[model samples]
Target chain A: MEEIKEIMKSHTLGNPVRLGIMIYLFPRRRAPFSHIQKALDLTPGNLDSHIKVLEKHGFVRTYKVIADRPRTMVEITDYGMEETRKFLSHLKTVIDAIHF
Target chain B: MEEIKEIMKSHTLGNPVRLGIMIYLFPRRRAPFSHIQKALDLTPGNLDSHIKVLEKHGFVRTYKVIADRPRTMVEITDYGMEETRKFLSHLKTVIDAIHF
Candidate 1:
């Protein structure tokens, strides 16, 4: 019955912040930390910690912008997008299973 | 901002199986393993592993029934209910933040 690996729970995108980040990035492809912070209404510290975990997991990678003032930019890696999609698909299956 | 506890992500119901279990048990209060297995369409092995994790985390408790044929039963702990509620509430806020 279990076709996929049984470690979907271990994905770092399991957190709401990370989930929100993935949803936000899904459209834009990339965005600055401040933009995400504002869009998600997350504190700088809270958002930073969550993104740090994603970066550590290689689900997301970050870089410093080269402008008048340097800003941190973040984006979901191809692997991250793939994993996030899988996770969401898994969740949808669970919900659907319960419904009918 | 971070008003509630910051460890919401650490809660074990973050898993889809566990989340599905909690949602299934929320109104029923308890259920047979086979019932949940069929309802969620999970492989017995898959559901067992996820339930083991939840039991280990004290989110759920299990026992054997002394019926015509022995069977396993499972239910969410009070702490699990509380924590699951918090997790859902947190997710709602994150999604709401993105919407407005």
Candidate 2:
């Protein structure tokens, strides 16, 4: 939890688009690329880039469906789940501490 | 907390320097500029810029000491505290979700 908090301390989550993606994927065991794109209102390129970053950091896993049409599915791993919880908790702590 | 989470989702806080400043200020009622700098290993210029960003968001409060050696004091606001907590929580959530 401390590690996750440390990582998230530098950047505050302001991009609703990304938060939408994370929240959607966070609860689900797995989801397809198209599903995420539609839910996030993001272009293929934009979502692709976001997923790539998450993947690069080992926060998400991508499984390619090699059927008639290639489909990519994403899943949040344990590490990712921990990060999500930590992120949310930290925000709550900070909010609770707010002066106003 | 939700608002803070939304804001922090876009950028992951990876800058240790910024995190240090935040943690230091988070628990303290007020701290001087030099105190934060020495504790954070940040130069005046770097710390000043960081403080400016936090100040812009109303996360921190600054006061000048007119006794003698021209000192500046900063305190974290309630809003900032809430933001800090939210940020930490979200990161934890993300980490917990990771597979590995």
Candidate 3:
């Protein structure tokens, strides 16, 4: 329960949007901003704000990539990956502890 | 993500202590106040406050049971059981969606 409380209070993943962004980026490592916005069904402005929060927490980095056109990309930092992993593992522990 | 957000915003289980209380009572259905306090490592006053919130939400009912002595026992209502089950199921979905 203490662990769950701590996880819930996490600065980076406390909000649902940020948590969704992190979960989406955890496996892929990096993704285009547009792709994330589409996948999460968030507007550009909303995603940007949440991404800023994640960046401020050192959980993610955003930069522009030049391909056919200039596009924004969001990538999870190593620290972010580790923290997300720990959160998920602790959550699994809590879930498993419940017998029924 | 929406489901996760809804669960996080739940009035009864939003707080960690109340969530812990629900999880602890889900299986047992009913438990003594002292046992809950001991199990969750919460102060008597702290547990009382959380229990009051749960009761107000119609999640639990507290009453005195006179066995050897009068002891306050907390029991989960059917509504609480249903809501807790839904919360756990939604959480499981979110966890399963993460394929890292």
Candidate 4:
């Protein structure tokens, strides 16, 4: 429980949208902004705001990839990966603690 | 992700302390306040405040049991159990989806 509380203190990832974003990025490490928006069903504005918060916390970084056209990309930082992993581990402990 | 977002909308349980309380009470169904305080290592005031929030949301009920002196007992309500289960299930999905 104390562990969970400590993890929850990472307010940036505490939001489900942000958590979802991190979960999506954890394995991929990096993804196009459009893909994240579609995958999470978040509006452009909503996704932008969440990304800004993550960027501010050094959890993620947004950049542009000049492909067919200019495309925005979001990548999880090493710090972000470490924090997300820690958060997930604590979350699993809480889930294991509760028995149905 | 949508499922996780929906479960997180239950703001009362979103707080780590409140979530901890529910997890603690889930198996026992009921417990003395002192036991909960000790198990969660929460101060009496801290525990009381969290209990008030849970009580307001009908997640739990508090009452006195006459024993060796009067002791306050906290019990999980049916709604709480269902919500906690739902939250845990969604959480599990997020964990499962993220391949470490």
Candidate 5:
């Protein structure tokens, strides 16, 4: 059962863009669109679409804050953390195997 | 170095159709095109293209034999075996997590 979740995590994180999002979000806990966009060098529309999918899957959470101006931020959920761990472990396994 | 190869293997096998082909071929040493097509319930053209890709990648070997009739049989190679193991392990992790 746990193993299956790991595979789903791997499959989800298989894409470079999606994986980059998770890697970025996993550490800091939360970030805004600009932060991620700048880090990954992806266009706004492309990053937005993938973030929406991750949000839909409950792997990420989004919050809109109003202090002086409207701000949108995203964070990894508990579910996302577990998923990320599995993905990283699997990724580590793969990276460990590269010869040249 | 080894780790990177493993990741490449996982990335390569991430596609469902390709995964199915490796799964089918791993158990049996060799099989003909029609056999794989029927077993996987895939169309001939679909199976053929994927098989061509697998053959090109050195993951599979295709042999042509003539006795009374010409026969084409495909087998998983050593490289394919290592790749298949990683894919299966990764797959097991995913199946283990599916709930409901």
Candidate 6:
């Protein structure tokens, strides 16, 4: 239980915005910043902050494409995917344990 | 989609810790503040801030018991519970739609 608590508290993917990002990245493995912004209904500034948190924690890798629009792309690294998996699992355990 | 985004952004239960609190409160409808803190493994300071945010949003109602220990009790209002349900549902919709 203590270990679970630590994992829950320390997880970097601690917000709905970020959770949405990880889940969104799961199947596609990667996506453009604009697509994620549109899908999650997040403002560009808001999404940027959340993505930076994930990137800092090594949950997501970010890069830019020199396209006509010069788009930015985001992808969940292996570590990030594992972290998301663990965060979800820990959350479920905590919720179940606290069931009335 | 824009409306969904607005609801997601304006929602007060925006963190993992708060989400855990709502899930714990769902079955029991109410619990002591200490219990919520322990169950979610949050500090008194941390839990207090989260609870206050919920209360401010009319999602939770909080009161103090003048017992020997003076425990604070927290309850999820009907509105709060419904809001939690919507948050969960909206999150799922975003995830499904953003599937790569």
Candidate 4 matches the true fold with a TM-score of 0.80
DockQ of every candidate structure: 0.17, 0.16, 0.24, 0.39, 0.10, 0.29
lDDT of 6 at A58: 93
State residue B19's C-alpha deviation in candidate 4, in Å. Answer: 1.9
lDDT of 2 by residue, B1-100 (tens): 3432454343323244455567677767589999887766668998898788778877788989977789999898898777767665654554445442
| Per-residue C-alpha lDDT of model 4 across residues B1-100, encoded as one tens digit per residue | 6775665466787676787788888889999999999988889999999999999999999999997799999999999899889888888887977766
Tell me the tens digit of each residue's lDDT in model 6 across A1-100.
5534544475576665677678778778899999999888778999999899999989999999987889999999999877776665655555445423
lDDT of 6 by residue, B8-52 (tens): 474476666677678778878999999988877789999999899
Clashes of 4: 0
Q: Against the hidden reference, what TM-scores do the models get?
A: 0.60, 0.57, 0.68, 0.80, 0.53, 0.78
Best by lDDT: 4
Ranking by DockQ: 4, 6, 3, 1, 2, 5
Q: Give per-residue lDDT, candidate 3, residue B79.
A: 94
Q: Chain B TM-score for each model? A: 0.84, 0.77, 0.93, 0.95, 0.78, 0.80
Model 5 Cα lDDT, one tens digit per residue, B1-100: 2232233345456554665677667767688877888777778898888888888888898988787888788899999888778655543443233321
Evaluate all candidate structures by whole-model CA lDDT and list the values in order.
0.70, 0.66, 0.81, 0.85, 0.68, 0.75
Is candidate 1 or 3 superior in TM-score?
Answer: 3
- Over B9-99, each residue of candidate 1 has an lDDT whose tens digit, in order, gives 4457655556667777765778999998887777999899989998898888999998999999998889877776666555444433442
- Worst lDDT window (10 residues) for model 2 chain A? A7-16
Q: What are the RMSDs of all candidates, in order?
A: 5.7, 5.9, 4.0, 2.8, 7.8, 3.8
Which pairs of residues have clashing backbones in candidate 6? Answer: none
Question: What lDDT is obtained when candidate 5 is compared to the true structure?
Answer: 0.68
Candidate 1 clashes between residue pairs 3 or more apart in a chain or in different chains: none
Of 2 and 6, the candidate ranking higher by TM-score: 6
Q: Which candidate is the best by TM-score?
A: 4
Q: Is the docking of candidate 4 incorrect, acceptable, medium or high quality?
A: acceptable
Give the CA lDDT, 0 to 100, for residue A75 in model 3: 94
Comparing 1 with 2 on TM-score, the higher-scoring candidate is 1
Where in model 3 is the C-alpha error above 4 Å? A8-11, B1-21, B28-75, B97-100
Lowest summed lDDT across 10 adjacent residues in model 1 chain B is found at B1-10
